[model samples]
Target: MSKENKHITVFEHESLRTDRGEQRLTNGQLEALQLFYGENGVPYYSLIHHGVRFNEYVGVIQVGKTVIEVLPKADKSNDADRWRNVLINMLHAVGIFDIHAPSNSNLRLRSNSILDLYFELFIKEVEYLLHRGLVKKYRKTEGNRTALKGSIQFAKHISQNLVHQERFYVRHTTYDKEHDIHAILYKALKLLSYINTNVQLNSRLGALLLDFPELYDIKITEALFDKIALDRKTEPYRNALEIAKLILLNYHPDVNRGTNNVLALMFDMNVLWEQFVYVSLRRHKANATSIAAQNTKNFWKPLSGYRSKMKPDIVLNKDTEDCVVLDTKWKNLNGYNPSPEDLRQMFVYMKYYGAKKVALVYPGSENRNQSGQYYDHSSQDSKHLSNEECSVISIGVEKDVKAWQKIIHENISNWCQLQEIV
Candidate 1:
């Protein structure tokens, strides 16, 4: 590992090393990674003998000053830049980050890693909010005032201020910027200032910190965010607050060792791929009457205990009849057949959902859709095979997100014997 190279890009299930078999992580970085993957944390990666090996989770993880960007690789191409672009496009398609940034080209050109892109987006949002002026809200503040204003705490006033009769201890309402939204933004900005490695963004971050007012730090929690009610006045801060929640939630500082301050913004590739495909298909519904994602059905139940449910990734319907059930797998088939487990799962889904057909979807370099029929095991005559069909669909990944999505829609529509509505 070299201090000069702060940013490194690797794909899922890859070792933390370069092509030449050189170690990319120093001892401290490796230690930090171990601690992050330790107990009580999401197991994003495994601790290899040499270093950490990223699993199916893809995104950016920053330990100390080093940023490790793990990207998804379904195709055979090992081009880091292409995969990076695909990941960003997938994220945008899935609505993780809005694509309304001022200059996507500039951010893509200047950003070295996904972390840099996130930092740039946060900074841009905060800058926009500042230019528009921060919003204020009414908050309850309790203090000792010389003049009586709000409701006074008689108990506290008598006990604490017995000698000072002029002073009034009261809880008053004041409209100010000391709210949860500002506190979240301030915390995110402060965290960015510390973990950000991009040299160009430092000055902008510095300017933001200088201009942004410092409010009282409060405990950050998901419940706090859930309680936030955004009206017309606070609507402008939505994007900034979204980014702040992302940063503040993912950041885990090493309180004991004070060395490995981990900021992991990772996404499960399986979940992301499923979502990307579902959204792409949903976008171009073609001739299908309706499309549902993760539709569940009660599959099994015990005599007394709770029953188990089975969820199919995507279910396509033609009018009132179940047409197709699709299970999306984020892997490159590479001329290999679908696993027995996958085939069995699809068969079960088709039977449970009463779908006329089912398919196992995947991502690959080129389109490879293979159709097969299941045999009737209970048939006495060998010639009497069931008419149930299942197809293995590998939707090709293109450079452009729209193009890939179009391919998916077309292939699925054609396979399901549905004409494009357009």
Candidate 2:
């Protein structure tokens, strides 16, 4: 397939119409998407009657030869290419991609999709690892050998080696490059070789596969990645291993058809926005202030079973007390009123966390700051307002990520300082 024909770009909440030319997906591709949605709970897209409507998640999804790049769009005027760059910058800010600097020349390439960037980065990591020499670890092995090495299994040795007296069944530990980490990298490389459509990355990927050791395939799972422990010697492989884990875990191969494997490399924009805000604040926070992400507090308890907890996206603490609680929303307000549920939730967070100020943070075209106060039930006068304040702060997105982050930190710091005045 030609690159132009195979690549499709759509924004969040947009539909992939089946009748649209150059944007319609094949039946095989739809089937692959259906399977992926069915298996992955909290799907990124919903199946329409004749199309697929993507939600607030953005990233690349590759089905067979077709690559669908979903970009985040909070503004009506933003295009796919612009939001694509924003998404890439956001990912880099959150440390998802380890690139030192992404140039305009790189982002301007129409031929490169997010998947291509991912493949190229993975290939580079593997190339560096091969240059430094693959790390070897001691792994336990059990098999039949001609010469006796470690302690022999008596039952297996007696049964299997009865006919062949020279053969021995023994369990031994061998120090070699054939370990779980290498196994994972090898698996990711093999997957890339099969699904990658980039012509430029193919030769480099081929060289990586040749240099990378062929290890036995193991079942890829969350637990497998959790079990990995890196020391000083293997620390350099951290970036490569992180990417490998992402690729191996997200890939779902078709068992019945074998051709329409689905690889969904996606991120929830809401979550990403929250993280980006938290990272920005943490990086530029005052010496006395500390920032935490996803702080949970006990909200409700049933007579039996697990208790419910309220987890706010970001919390800022000055010295010891909670200074401000900020909940990040990815949607553009556009002068619309905040949702009632969101206001009530922030109120609960304020009362429970003892935060003097609470804010709902959003992304918008221009910087907006709105402030309000909660009604005090204890006051005899119904019109009396409490000292606790709730504000809506929107930080505008800038062309440069550093400038955008600076705006975020500045706005948030100002919000925190306001609490000190009262």
Candidate 3:
């Protein structure tokens, strides 16, 4: 086949050609592209010895008749696995293979296939949300409210009135008339009024503001009301409310616009994990319970009088007996790994809570010499156990989610199996 025909076509909303070598995208840039293009439509393809084949569907950008194939920028072979994951995610979003399936089936596609083998593992999570009634249709109800008449159906109404407005704005307005200042100002004021009014009328935005009190902006609140009162055209009102909803849902307060400080990075990481990792884990029947240092304080008093409360990042429970403790640290584990103090604290939790496994999960960067066992000074003889003895594993957070889930699942399963054996 011809080179053009052999390569799978990928479409993007914007042009991709560049004269200055290759363009590299950061994680944040890749994420934005993924979100804007819809997580499901992008595609990833592989080239072997000049032959190209569609490896997996990453995401698609539908512009008229064109569809774009997208993959994370692959500067090296190691980046292939990560970019493949992005492709698998897009595939999952478009309803391909069921993410959650039993471990013993042909369902486990090879990790190298761009088809995530653990897709089945995520199905239980989606089902959980469905069972809980948390997921709902995107647009179930029509207008802003019952009283707004046709305002809720503003987009539809705009389609019908295109000709009338086209004539007034395009044809009637004088091309060279600089003195039509009054008309221009009137149009501007009308547009502003429409935005303010419609945003105020958006019940979804209002509900979001109420749900997340942190997102409440006084300027946004005031502008929404003003638009509702002044705008006669419905399109501006509808557009404004749409923008408001996007802001309310995605806005993160902790991110400093400039520097990538520890706090800002943590906030960004949390946001990404909340949407992609946490949500996916929850969908799979993985109970991600929050056990902050404060909430865990009462459980630790019998062990030590130490007033310090350290909240591990996440507690995964298959039940009371089958539990895995995880703490997410944004920093890399410099060869200094978890200190003797860190081991003691985790040991206390394992002993008190009867936790079978513990993990000090950190962002993957540097390699540390992990011996997989730590001493517990609390024991009379200073007993030492294999890391897997009580099941303590330090994993890298930067590993693919599938790998991370497998580690967690394997540990939890081993603990449960041990209980059965006993």
Candidate 4:
């Protein structure tokens, strides 16, 4: 499908495409996207249409595509493993429903559509939820080979046929599938089937689904889940449910029903990167150190009683005295220098928050990709911080987990000025 035409796609950050040439966000759409970003605090996209510019950074944005259809930007192909893994890991790190999807065969390679990828991963989660404990209830059945399972349905009893002179009874029965976990699983699976039935599936996921016995056959929707109350017994379904609800709700041609109604299943790279950075850093918090995401909800009192918010992205403190404030930007600092607005924001954070140093952490450029180690780059300037200095830290995103952990650890240790632990 042409990008300018209608389609539901999973897009990566700074990745919007256009083939129709000159394009820009319509005034109404521009206001709407920005307003949503402001409320959510996730810098969604950068629009540069016909010399008009807005948002944190600048990029080409197409017109004509409906807000719900274009959905958002598109840079990276969804076919690669990096794209999906990043989304899953970031969601996991941020604690948005803890899910560790076991590495499977070519889930990334086989699936290309947004709907396809979501359902493929989502089915695994549902399979996990149900497999953790197969949702079982006393389902009514009537057969000549087995005993009566539930109360008999005398009205439609078929006792005419006998199997091998029958050692068991035959009767009609009506029983409860319970609308419990089993019903949810059944409905969720049915929803998965509807997501994209025509799309081709990789051998791995197709085989994986067959592992679980079809638990139930029932109709369900987003509302079906809402009415059911879950307790500690069925708590395992929580994480999987959060993901399923989104996929089922927005994984359609019409994301929402009518008039400029755009229900996005997309995430802002800036938001995800910031969350991942903070989550990764917090893993190494020392006994004598403290780290706060978004700075303890602390605001600066610029004019006594007239509170001004000084919400930096991250704050690290050693023994509660010398603190280093850090903020994350999704843009590649290697190609693009830090903007004056970014510098001013950090400067204000350092001056008002009493930070020793403020590091503007950003994703390093793909050109600097290294093997077996993360490429680290920084530009230190003495003018930024009040009496100290600021570090514009950029680290490679393509590194393996252990390498990234080590790289970030070293950066934090040096940035905080804490003595390295042996």
Could you say which candidate leads in lDDT? 1
- For residues 339-367, what per-residue lDDT tens digits would candidate 2 score against the true structure? 98998999998888888789999999888
Better of 3 and 4 by lDDT: 4
Task: Superpose all Cα atoms of candidate 1 onto the true structure and report the RMSD in Å to 1 decimal.
Answer: 2.7
Candidate 3 error regions (>4 Å): 1-218, 221-267, 270-310, 316-321, 330-336, 339-344, 362-371, 379-422
lDDT, candidate 2, equals 0.82
- Candidate 3 per-residue lDDT, tens place, 74-154, comes to 122235546556545533433443432234323433443321122222223222322333211122233222233322344
Q: Decide which is better by TM-score, 2 or 3.
A: 2
Q: After superposition, how far is residue 234 of candidate 1 from its true place, in Å?
A: 2.2
Q: Can you write out model 1's per-residue Cα lDDT over 145-259, one digit (the tens) per residue?
A: 9999999999998888989998999999999888888988998899899888788989999999999998778799999999999999998788778888988998888776776
**What is residue 369's positional error in candidate 2, in angstroms?**
0.8
State the TM-score for model 3: 0.33
lDDT of 4 by residue, 1-422 (tens): 44433433324332333322234334444454444445455443554442222333211122224433222222333444464444554554576534545555224435433344555566667656545655444445565444555454443343533333433444544444354556555555654543333235434345545665556564447677787666765566665667667654543332232223233455556776778778777776666667778754455566556665667788877224577788888765545557878876776676677776677887764323211111222335533423345667776654255456556666666655665320
lDDT of candidate model 1 versus the reference: 0.83
Candidate 2, poorest ten consecutive residues by summed lDDT: 100-109
Go through the candidates in order and give each one's C-alpha lDDT.
0.83, 0.82, 0.35, 0.52
Order of all candidates by lDDT, from best down to worst?
Answer: 1, 2, 4, 3
Worst lDDT 10-window in candidate 1: 99-108
Better lDDT candidate (2, 3)? 2
